[model samples]
Each structure stands twice: as structure tokens, then as C-alpha cells.
Target: MPELGGPTSAPALLRPHDPAPPLLDAARLGVAAHRGLDVEALLTWTTDTADLLPLPGTGSTAALWSALASVAAADVGAARVLEPHLDALAVLAQAPTPVDLGAVGAGGSSTWGVFAAEGPGVRLEAHEVDGGWRLTGTKPWCSLAGTLSHALVTAWVSDDERRLFAVGLRADDVLPAAGPWVSRGLAQVVSAPVTFDDAPAVPVGPPGWYLRRPGFAWGGIGVAACWWGGAVGLARALWDALGAREADQLALAHLGAVDVALTAARACLVEAADQVDAGIDGKPSAVLARRVRTVVAGAVEEVQRRCAHALGPGPLTADEAFARRVADLGVYVRQHHAERDEAALGRDLLAAGVAPW
Candidate 1:
């Protein structure tokens, strides 16, 4: 396992005498203001060394563990480093039968994101064109838009139909919005709105295929794995803070609470991974994904709250690593969509009116 603040040159647990891992590469990431992460290195390590992408199911539980470990490491390592790759993995998951996973695995050289943030804000539209397809309009919340070479994007194909398109971000007429992102938390991630002018694209799947796929649900739950790992990182910090040193009963109690929360979250994540690997046909996968995401999100919040209460402002303010973990987790978990997702899941379950066990 890679040590928190970037991997140690040598294994620290086995050889305590070994030098500590190098501190995160600040220069590669960026300076103080709006830090840009050195995502390439992180992606490279995950691809070549960890070999975590294209998540070949059944025989590949290693990918799940590796994904969780990397996310936790990212929380300690770069804070905003894992999102793009996660997006890419989700893309690879739903890719068409003819699509090549070989090129995509090594295409860590070419960073990717799932640019599907559509709303009153910025909605991309796809049109059938002379050769392949063309996408127009704008995509918001495009993480690493300026840097991502490829993206699995969603665009409106018709009033009632939306399709997924595999696009080259560097293609002509696509523009990354500037000056909109203004947050220190997950600031290493460069998310911005983008404008497109009929950029050429290749359709990944047919209309409505993106949201209809089991991978869509799996991707939703996979996010919870990262959140679970992040909470574990915070819980470990609490453990380290207590150590053998004397602490008040309240602090110890809070640590206990954090421990329980993280343990439960991990179990849910593992079970969800198994279901995802085994493939539950139809809405059962979606149901499990929603249930697990909801459970893990709540656990993450509990861990965050308990850690803050027990540890106080010192770690959140003074300790750079702990602060980043807390901050990034806060922002990243917003992918949960709070009540909106809950309402949708609840309404769907109500409509179905029976548990699919």
C-alpha cells in the first residue's frame, strides 16, 4: 500500500528506518492560487503499476480495492487527483462492444472526463453530420476540460432522446470556459464550462443508452467507494491523533463512532462491488447502487462530523493533509445530489412497490 503523502521511496511499515515518501509535488500541481493537479503522474501509476482500469469483472476484485486505495491516497496525496480517472473508468465501463479497451487503458497519457453536466446552465446537443456526429452548445462542470484530451459526453439527440458521445476535447471549435471555478477545495481539479461548435464526435451508444446502462448505476456506487476511502482516511487521522497519548473520554468516544461508521461503509461498498461484478439484471443493480450510495454518503458525513468534533479546528486549519482530506471530501460527495437523488430513488421504488431480493 502506498503511504499517505505520496508513496514512500521504500516501504515504511516494513522498514521504519527507510526514508519517508516524498512530499506531494507542489510544483507539478501548481502554486497557492487555484492549484492544478499533476494528474498525469497519478494516472500513470494507476495504469502501469496498479493496473486498475477497464475493471474486468468477476476475477478482478483487485480493481475495486485498488480504486478505493487510490482514492484514499488521493485524499492524502493530491486531494483532487482521482476524479478524472474515475470518470474515465466509468466511460470505459459503458463503452460499445467494438470499442478498444487496450488503447483506453494506456490513454492515461490522454486524460478523460465524463462531461455530462447539463441544465439551464449549459446543455450540449448532438446532430447527425456528414461524417459521424457533431456536438454543439456548452457543457458545464467539465473537470479538466482544458487538459482532458478525451471525454465520454452526453448530449441531446432529440427532444425525447439523449445520447452518449465519445469526443476528443482537443478537437476544433471546443472551448474551455475561463474564470468561473473559484474554490480551494478540490481546486487541483480544473472544472469549467465548455462551449462547442459542431465538433466532430463518435457516438458511444444509442440514444438514452448512457443513463440506461448498468454501468451508470455502477458508476454512481463507485463514487461512494471513494467517499468511503476518504472517510477512512479521516478516521485513521483520528486514530493517529489519539495514539497512546492520553485523551479525554469524549474524544475517544468520537473516535469509536468514526470507527463504526467507516466499518459499516466499507462493508456496504464491498457488497456493492460484488453485485456490480456479478451483474444484477435490470433495476436491482440500480436499487443496490442507490441504497449503497445513500448509506455510504451518510456514513461519510457522520465520519466528517465526528472527526471535526473530536479533533477540533487544529487539524482542519493547521494540518495541510487533514484539512485537504476534509475539504475535498466535502466537495466530492456533493455528487450525491442530496434530496434530488433520494426523491427519485424513493419514487421509483414506490412505483415498483416491491423489493427485488
Candidate 2:
């Protein structure tokens, strides 16, 4: 596994460490700040590596997904901090081979982590500006606000065409608003609401670019990897903590179970990545993507819950890693696709009387 902050020849930024842990208390606000900075650095590193971009004929999507999953599992706030990079990823996929990770990171890494398009609380809109584009709206769940450099936001072009854009975090372009993301769980994400009063933006590609491509499916797989990583991390933490305790048997059993679950999830991720690389487009790939998401989500939840119980309450309360893993798992598992949608896909496959393999 790649170390979080190892030295590299890439033009990415590096985060310095702080003595305090972000979640300790109000006095540890500095820790949160430091964490946010670290997250930005990590995002830069990710965006700098062309391997992180999905390319034609490159069977590397699974690897990238796994890496992103590890980061999200370790720190969801950091994952959020990298949202702009994710957007730039979509653009990178359309660009030439040997992708310019530095350009992608520099273009969008900052604002992407702080912008949102889902849920009823956030609204985003964009219009063509002189040379770039103008974004006007508010986004809820803007994670890593104080740290992110730009946001890749989605907005309507005349209320019909949905376009994606990269917007810089200029003082004149964005307005900060109070947010409701104060849950004790996933608190490190620090998602807040952002209001855009005619914010300036830059169009990434043609209209309906994101929704019309396989990039969305690929993005979903990346997120699934993150949740899977979190689950694996939680399981590892629990197993290590209780390996020598009286509940050793239970811990062993849980560890075995978690390993199986994670392995299965990884298999699915690899398969999905292969299919994507092979240009297996449309509903079949979409169905497989959904299945991957569902399986990963279920496996991670099971691992987190069981591992937490196996470790007992003492470790849960005192171990920052364990506690954060649990909280991160809780927040990530909710991104599961609707059961009915997944089941409908299964039903269609079954009715076809053909092996989906």
C-alpha cells in the first residue's frame, strides 16, 4: 500500500502533522485544520498520478478504485476533499493517454471537495460566462471547505441540459453559509452548506457530459471501493485489538468473515473494472455496477458491526482509529443503491435465462 505522505517527484502538496487528533474536542480545531490540509495534499497526489485516471485500454480502474476506497475509509473528510479531482477524473478519461494528473489536480481539486448536487438541501446551476462559465446556486454537504481549492459542480443549461463545470474558490465567486452536517458520526467530513451568488464557473465539456457517459458508473465503483476499504480497516483494527483477549475465538471468527467479505467485494470490483475497461456499456454494465455497490456496502456494514462488537466497548471508546473507522463505516454504508432497483436488475437477468458472466 502507498504511504499517505511519502515523498514523490510529483508536483503535489504535502501536509504537515499536528499533535492533536481532530475529533478530540473543540480545542483540537487545529487538528481538524491540519487534517484538512493533509487531505488536500493526498488529493493532489492522487490527481498527479495518471494511474488514478480511467483510460482507454487500461485495466487500471479497479486499482484506482481500490486506492480511492482506502483513502475514503481512512478519512471520509479527505475523500470529500478530493471531489474536484473526481470531477477532473471524468475529464481526464476523455483526454489523451499518459494523463496529466498535475493539470487535472490543479484545475479542480480545490472546489470539488466542497460542492454537492444530491439531496433536497442543495441546488446548483451554471451558465456560460465570457471565457469560462458562471455557476449560481447553493450546495449542501460541502466537505473540506476551508481547504478545498475548487469544486466540480453540476447545473442546468436552460433547465434542460445538465452540464458539469470546474469553479474556483474565489472570494467574489462563493459565499459560505451555516450547514447542518453536525452529526457525531462522520463529523470529520465537516460538510457544510455553500451559497453561490452568481459564482463564476468554467465548463468542463459539452452538455450532459457526465450523465451521458460511463464515467458515472465508474465513479460509483470508486466510492464503493472506499466503503469497502473502510470496512477492511475496521475489521483489521478490531482483530488486532482483541486477538489476545478472552473473546479471541469470536475475534478470529469475525476476522475470517471480514476477510471473506472483503475478498468477495474485491473480486466484484476487479470484475467490474475489467468490464468497464472492455467497453462493456449500457444496462448490463450498469447492473453489474449496482451489484458491486450493493455487495460492497453489505459486506462493509457486516464487518464494521461485528468487529466493533467483538472488540468490546473499551477499545471503541479509547482507540481513535477504531472509533473513526466505525463512524466512517456508518456514514459510507448509506450510499447503497435501492434494493428494489438492484433486485429488478437481478430479476431481468434471471428471466433472460442467461449467465451474466
Q: Give the range of the ten consecutive residues with the poorest summed lDDT in model 1.
A: 6-15
Best by TM-score: 1
- Candidate 2 residue-wise lDDT, 66-99, digit = tens: 4455455445555444434664555545632342
Off by over 4 Å in 1: 1-36, 43-56, 61-66, 73-80, 83-90, 100-108, 355-357
lDDT of 2 at 60: 52
Alpha-carbon TM-score of each model against the true structure = 0.82, 0.75
* Number of the predicted model whose lDDT against the real structure is largest: 1
For every model shown, the clashing-pair count is 0, 10
Per-residue lDDT of model 1, residues 1-357, tens digit only: 223233211211212332222222333223211222455555454344224343524434335444444445345334344544555565665566555433323354655678777767667899987656888999888877786677888899888788887777775688887647786667767688888898877777678877887677776676676677677777777777887479899987997787677677667766666666787646877777788888889988998999889888989879987887787788888888788878878877887888655
Regions of candidate 2 where Cα sits further than 4 Å from its true position = 1-57, 72-87, 95-111, 114-116, 129-132, 246-249, 337-357
